[model samples]
Target: MITSYNFYFCYIEIHEDYVKAVMKEGITVSPEHNDVLLQIVEKHYKNIPFVYITHRINSYAVDPTIYLETAKISNMVGFAVVSEDPKQKIQIKLEKTFFNKEFKQFDTLELALKWKDDMIKKYRD
Candidate 1:
């Protein structure tokens, strides 16, 4: 079963092996947002491995530093960003630098979901 959540800053869909987040337009995603993410992880993911897929349908800014605290989540197997914007692609490069684990970029949500499955399988194996 897939569960969905609506926050002021983003909308999230939680699946068995992944969490897909769609951030609000024009907002800066900072470390503070990770608190709600951790709560979701604790409640739904717990010990199970899962990937985070950010479906960037709307324009937004992200604080690269947020990845530092996110890297501390042991069960988080990967982080995937999906965006068609060329500019967002460039921003991803800088954001990837701050992340210590598997980080990937995709032009579509389908591709990101595929990566999420592969990441979870790799983590389990």
Candidate 2:
């Protein structure tokens, strides 16, 4: 997995097949930052099947549209987000739209990773 993080954002790139990768950091609400993020994801990782977000809401509000676009491009089959803030609801809606369905959410990254691992095993078989 490849990772990138700035003061305002963070991302991870999973480079395995039959195995999914996830970004543990959440993104900020800035349009510019989101744009930069999209470019990065597009440029470096476009085929990952799963992505996990761990950015806290206080640091930055993640725009769901950005994640939606990423999922669209990555053809991401599943997503797990860990946030304690209610504001993340908006992102959740956006994720659902991007996935055309609901995604799993957890309060901790460990749960998300465990779930993703189980999912990968299921999908791989």
Write one digit per residue (lDDT tens) for candidate 2, span 23-70: 334434544655655665556546654444443434445555655455
TM-score of 1: 0.97
Number of the top candidate by lDDT?
A: 1
Q: Per-residue lDDT for 28-97 in model 1, tens only?
A: 9987899999999999999999999999999889999999999999999999999989999999999999
lDDT value, residue 2 of candidate 1: 82
**How much does candidate 2 score in TM-score?**
0.57
Clashes found in each candidate (C-alpha, N, C closer than 3 A): 0, 2
CA lDDT of each prediction against the hidden true structure? 0.93, 0.52
Which candidate achieves the best TM-score against the true structure? Answer: 1
